[model samples]
Target: MRDAETVTFGGSALNRAAELRARPDEIAALLNDPAARAVPLWRGKPSIDGAGALGWVAANHPVLRDGEEPAIFLGSDETGPLFTIDLSAWQPETGADPVPASFFDATEQRHPGLPDGHRFAELRNIMADLSARDAECAATAKALIGWHRSHRFCSACGEESGVAQAGWQRVCGACGAVHFPRTDPVVIMLITRGNSALLGRSPGWPEGMYSCLAGFMEPGETMEAAVRREVMEETRVRVGAVRYLASQPWPYPSSLMLGAVGEALDETIILDPNELEAARWVSREDMARAFAGDHPEIRAPRRGAIAGFILRNWLADRLD
Candidate 1:
């Protein structure tokens, strides 16, 4: 993918000053600095400004102070330091959807002090609208927030943990164990023949929508091997000569998608009964029609998603 960095959430220019994360004095000074800004997440929804862009506020905002733990060091740009705070329990204007207690809806909220006309919106609904910088900040915030929420206990000692390392680590008081945020690796491949690409639709995906075969990386598997194995398992295609192309940070709950292009040694469709509802080879012209929203039987993935970015770039002959 020639312009792979142009893919959404792939090309953030922030200098993540990791050295300063352990310097409490410096970080505290940053918190007090007038130019330091904070991005707030309320139940996974981001604070959007009146202009429909990612919104930032003074680090000293009251809601930021209300956060239970120290803010995560999101890094710094030429302007100043950037930070992320999770106020999921803060009094929002009713953010959670009416889904059962087991489900969550990030878009269901309104912030009182959001700039006029600003509202909290789900990342998926607004990812394509954000600048690359803003998208990086939001992804960072959502990922860390989700991890902290679910990993409140220590795995080693079965004890509660406390935030540490400027929110990059969790320290268990009982066992002195340390834990860090995790990024799950996923392989999404563009398996192609002369003029056709293999696509599959998972169960319950939107009608007519299909994307490249994808699966989680195993404990000791290589990226190239994962790509080949996933394609074979999902669609019974024998993929060879795999090459990595690009990557994207998909922060639904913290995932790094590794994009690859592979050669199909054999073209045979064998759908795993549990993995997909349908799998087929789509011709170039048909793929182009799907991109243009004119295909009667296929629809492309949404823009900003890794699958969509890979598919469109493949259609344009830019994956070389």
Candidate 2:
């Protein structure tokens, strides 16, 4: 977990410039500045040029028209500013098909103009391949765009909503309710007593693809408690002394994965049929085999996933 933030999309300690987002006038000024630039998103994939990913906000990207004027600004990162564009006032070019809600997948495609290795891939894949900054950009695009899509309607009064907080919040015109983006917290833990760790496979997962037992953090429950409860409920493995490990912001519709290591007090396997297809303990050596893709009966956890990361580290006795 020491190198957690080093992972792609693990967050690069970016300065989000919270104060700047609150000043509408300043944001407006930046949007209209001739020197400002844009980053076009086909869905959530960033536009790339042959010169590598074109520097956002300093080069050619998509432009958001604000009643004939450009109205977008840069989003800052740990390294510097990230280009963002507002599409509220723009229409599709003549004969050009608008990007579909699903076209976010297109950004991962290899394009001619993209800098070598600058193609869009799933965040999971990107985490394994790209730098932390690239992953952060991809995560930002996905989270912001997803918020835009889901908040077109106000949840409070079932009326329409408008963007606020520099795309971090939605304001409902009808009820005057403000809605902030949500990141659901989920706990993924490796439950162990002696040398064996508990793992489970969901019903629809690929055959033999087993990973750590996890569940969403319930309201009012501490993270450690959630890990204990989830493990007990799923595998009837009572847990004690839950230890926090690391976290990953899973932007598949916005989730923050809290990874942990739990000590199992009891080893009885009572699989909850509703929660998992199978649950059992695997020795540390067997886990190493799984990681190496040598286990004929099981597949290793998916790369770049929190589960895989945790399991790999656990196998090496590095989760301490």
Most accurate candidate by lDDT? 1
- Compute the lDDT of residue 96 as modeled in candidate 2: 44
Give residue 316's error in model 2 in angstroms: 2.2
lDDT of 1 by residue, 1-320 (tens): 67888888886888888899788899899988899999888777788887878878889887677777778889998878899887676665443442333223444466665556666777887888899899988998899988998899999999999998888899999999999999999999999998999999988777898988899999999999999889888888899899999999989788999999999998989899799999999999999999889999999787789888888888888897
Would you estimate the TM-scores of all the predictions? 0.94, 0.80
Expressed as tens digits, the lDDT of each residue in 1-320 for candidate 2 is: 67665544677665667788778887666555566455544444454444443324443433333312222233664434455543333344454443345413323454334244533334443356645665666566666666677678888799988877666677898899999888899999988879999889988677888989989999999999999999888888889898898898877768889999988888889989999999888998888888788988789877778888888778777786
Instruction: Give the poorly placed runs of model 1, Cα more than 4 Å off.
Output: 91-106
lDDT of 2: 0.69
Give per-residue lDDT, candidate 1, residue 64: 75
Look at candidate 2 and tell me the lDDT of residue 57: 42
Worst 10 residues of 1 by lDDT: 98-107
lDDT for model 1, on a 0 to 1 scale? 0.85
